[model samples]
Target: MRTVIHKLFFVWDFDKEEKWLCDMAAKGFTLVSVGFCRYEFEKCDPGEYGVRLQLLNHRLHHPESQHYLSFLEETGAEHVGSFLSWIYLRKRTSEGAFELFSDFESRIKHLNRIILMVISIVAANLYIGIFNILMCFFYHNEANYLGFINLAIGLIGSVGIWKLLRKRKKLKNDKQIFE
Candidate 1:
């Protein structure tokens, strides 16, 4: 019973009617007796453009009920094409306390990807570090230049591991907060 801003017009109040139409359209014949207002809703009538009163119901706005909107269309309610689409606020977990576990799982997947990339890069760099040191000894027999390069690469790989350890600590702290 909520108030609706109607665009319908009676025969007596016909002059106030919209320019593009001559009969009540979306009023759906509810206003048939506005002083003999026989609804002459031609296909091109402006009343065809008004909102359907049924859409204003609270039932359609509930979180679970939003699913009905799509089902309504599928069941031949073609009129929904003109209305706004419904939204869903779905999450991976329905429970409030366990929702962060879902979030942590997503973050852990991202961390695993990063760890895989770091492992591949570090493995390649360590191989290069060992080769440079060995080449310095075997071919040129000079330790200073290649030893410094190997040491720098080793330190960079160690720093990468340290950064990953710090991120893991932060992730652990976040998971504990959820518990």
Candidate 2:
């Protein structure tokens, strides 16, 4: 049987999202598909597979991403799903463990990628919001309430960026310790 779940996970919530997917697998559901705010899972033996997710440096179709994914596949990981630049992979429990980044440096790089994506979103939102507000004032249009919506989104994204930066800082400190 297949189960579909509709949920929202912000860009900075990747760790939470990954943990939720693993918890679902522990309960006998294995992720099969992913989309904007939607996840599809198929019933499987509980604890049969280990789940891992990564934020790619490029889109799945890009040659660099394709090659990296192919490398992972050669190591016995199965590509489960992708949404935007994020990819989900699963490996049999018998494989011991599934980890996308084994070192602090690699993890830090992944965090950087996520931070950059969030920054882009924040910038776009703020720019659009300001533009709409200006237009509303000049044209005397009330329907431009979308300006407030965009500004709100920008504010939320800014919080996410700050959290990501803090996470990255911790990773860097940890890296220095092991170096």
Pick by TM-score: which candidate is best? 2
lDDT of 2 by residue, 1-179 (tens): 88999999988988899999999999999999999999999999999888988998888999999999999999989999999889999988888788888899889989988999899999999999989999999999877889989999999999999999999999899888984
Candidate 1 Cα errors over 4 Å, as ranges:
1-102, 141-151, 177-179
Compute each candidate's TM-score over C-alphas. 0.36, 0.94
What do the candidate models score in CA lDDT, each in turn?
A: 0.42, 0.92
lDDT of 2 at 99: 88
Where does candidate 2 have its weakest 10-residue lDDT segment? 93-102
User: For candidate 1, lDDT tens digit of each residue in 1-179?
Assistant: 22223344321121244222222333332122111222223232233333221211234457655565555445433232211221111111122221112476555554555555556666776777787787877787756475567657666766766676567678878888873
